[model samples]
Target: MDLNLRKAILSNVSGHNTEQLEATIVDAVQNGEEKMLPGLGVLFEMIWKEASEDEKQEMLETLEQSLQHNQVQ
Candidate 1:
């Protein structure tokens, strides 16, 4: 996403509490609307960048397992 769009999303979400954030994410995922993906991707990227090595490894493992399970299904 462009910097401007990212900034706008961050600005909009800046004051949201944990419950609100979780609801937003759940809604985004359940809706499967393409427009929401970029914003969520940006959020994930920011968190991924700051994760510890062990945390990153764990996430990678979990993602791999998810992918594998999806493929099987």
Candidate 2:
């Protein structure tokens, strides 16, 4: 994503409370726009950076399962 786009997402996200942010992310993912995936990557990176070892392992397992499910479809 371009810097401007990243900034825009951050700005929009900053304006929202936690629930709204979650809803926005869910809506974005369901929309399935190609650009959204990179944004999701950025979100994942942020979360991973702060996550504990167990949380990271769980997330990786979940991601692997999601990828496998997508591949089967």
Give the CA lDDT, 0 to 100, for residue 68 in model 2.
89
At residue 27, give the lDDT of candidate 1: 91
How would you encode candidate 2's per-residue C-alpha lDDT over 1-73 as one tens digit per residue? 3467656666666667889879878987899898787667666777899999999999989989999889964
User: Model 2, poorest ten-residue lDDT window?
Assistant: 1-10
Compared with the true structure, model 2 gives a TM-score of 0.75
lDDT of all predictions: 0.89, 0.79
Please count the clashing residue pairs in each candidate, in the order shown. Answer: 0, 0
List TM-score per model, in order: 0.86, 0.75
Which residue pairs show collisions in model 1? none
List, residue by residue over 36-69, the lDDT tens digit for candidate 1: 9988987788789999999999999999999988
Runs in model 2 with CA error above 4 Å? 1-5
Q: What TM-score, to 2 decimals, does candidate 1 have?
A: 0.86
